[model samples]
Target: MRTPAARTRAGSAALAATAALLLGLAAAPAAVAGADHRQDATTLDGLAHRSGRYFGSAVDNPELADTDYANLLGSEFGQTTPGNGMKWYATEPRRGVFDFTAGDEIVNYARSKGLTVRGHTLLWHSQLPDWLSSGTWSADELRSILKNHITQVVKHYRGKVFAWDVANEIMNEDGTYRDNIFYKTIGPSYIADALRWARAADPKAKLYLNDYNVEGTGAKSDAYYALIQRLKADGVPVDGFGMQAHLALQYGFPYQMRQNIQRFADLGVDVAVTELDIRMILPADATRTAQQADWYGQVTSACLAVRRCVGITLWGYSDRHSWIPAAFEGQGAALPWDEELRRKPAYDAIGAALTAAAVRRTG
Candidate 1:
């Protein structure tokens, strides 16, 4: 019934309405894309920040000399652990004489990069100075020495470091205590005493007992759980547990890693992946690399699933300076970044896992 001009006008109006409707639908997704774009732009630390956690890496003093390595580390991670600078040998080289030069270098570097530090250790079986390791002392003498060492170190780095691995690698794989120099001389009570002294030195610093081979629910981890529970019952200032998570491809992925992290979280203390690295035999293949990526994602997911699994710190971010090549003969390529500072698949896997966690939290 309409004239030709009227028909054309109605057709134009309908087209305009359809286009506007289409634009409305497109704008809805565009808003979501904006969020996704923001997420993509965020750094690993930023993604972790969304979930109230941190992502960290370990850096040794010598490695910081590598400009590229240092720059990337300072930019990417939110936290750092001094690989060796904070150890007993580096911190206190002589009897009753302390030198914090090495640890200070790392702490200062971390500050420049806006990264908080986790004091690598106050005590460890290995890397002890000759004065402490080679000497023979009665229980009382050693106790005095231990208390002084812990108090001094913790006091020195108290405000700078958020946490301290008060004692490292104290238990054997069989769930029994390792007969290290401390155990042999100061007796088992040294563990509790060391924690107590560290607490007195810095009541605010989180205290943790760290060990490898405890990523899974095995005898080693069981020993730590029981020890931490007893320590808590007795009102020790035990604040967290650190699982070194030094995984090897040949050994297979840790058994029930998520469940293991959750169990430690239920104990009313934070859990952390203190030193994470996955190594394989020399000459990595596609299959191994893929599997390694899978393992990295799994570990990240496991940590993210638990509220108390505080953060993850790679032993070293890049294979360029990884300790595996020197320590583990015939096994290397253990880190997320390759020797050339190129990202390996593991890096992407970790990013994806962190991104997923952030998305879940925002959603």
Candidate 2:
């Protein structure tokens, strides 16, 4: 597998091809274009705010520096998550060594755009610096390390971030905690400890335990439910649950998404659709595109139904800079916008959902 740097360079080339594809699709006629833009309607954040929610997208550092992308981000989204800049590896390359350059850059950009920021994560098993990943440490030693890291990073972002993915991908698919280093070394309480340390560092930022495949009813989500219930009972500072809705058409939509969200809300915490994207086996056709669009509306509808579902955030907003193609071979076209910054069917579908939701409130 290519390193992230290599993939990023390759992604630029993919963007060029995607842009060409967008130009070809752009010639498809005016009616399609009009529909794609949601009838030249209001921004996503505008539509979401009407229904007392936020609409947001994740952003990486390089893309935020692009003028066109930056402008679109400012106008379209109310919140942003740094795709990687705030992660443990990026922030601390060595034991006791700290770096905030990348994260600070993103935070400043989000503030400039009047976009509230969500910290991507406080702890995860992957993407750790070599010192931590390869070294051996006792249980108490690892626990101290984790608490110190979480406290510092959370303190740095403090009032700037609305929430933190305090613990991420902690559970495996079968409703059990993955055998990650944190779990093995610090035991299950690492989650509650992480949340507590983060809360102490920044009392205002909402703390969340985020994971993929938890958007629907399943064993994995059930595990999260039990864990959350336990944590709440013990008075953990967990403020929200995050469902990383990374869907693929080949696998079918999640089973009864609304109920899945509602259960978490009933547990007394806000829920968010974080890192959302719908990818299909490549060479997108009208059929696949329409399916993707419909899925977007459905996701928004599910989130709207639950009062505590505070928001929906796209993993990244455009096909141009998406991590899909690289991460999942032969699969792409997973976002609402095409490479030329043009809205696709999914954009209109999302627009329609948000508008419909707001209308229901006003009606």
Q: What are the RMSDs of all candidates, in order?
A: 13.9, 8.5
Q: What shift in Å separates residue 347 of candidate 2 from its native position after superposition?
A: 0.4
Which residue pairs in candidate 1 have backbone atoms (N, alpha carbon, C) closer than 3 angstroms, thus clashing? none
- What is the Cα-based TM-score of model 1? 0.89
Cα lDDT computed for each candidate against the true fold? 0.83, 0.83
Q: Tens-digit lDDT track for model 1 on 160-268?
A: 9999999999999899999998899978999999999999999999999999989888788999999999999998889999989899888777757889889988999
- On the 0 to 100 scale, the lDDT of residue 308 in model 1 is 97
Clashes of each: 0, 0
lDDT for model 1 comes to: 0.83
lDDT of model 2 at position 223? 96
- Report how far off residue 52 is in candidate 2 (Å): 0.5
What TM-score does each of the candidates earn? 0.89, 0.89
Query: What would the per-residue lDDT of candidate 2 be over residues 61-173, giving only the tens digit for each residue?
Result: 89976777777876678888999999999999999888999999989987876788999888999999999999899999999999899988998888899999999999988
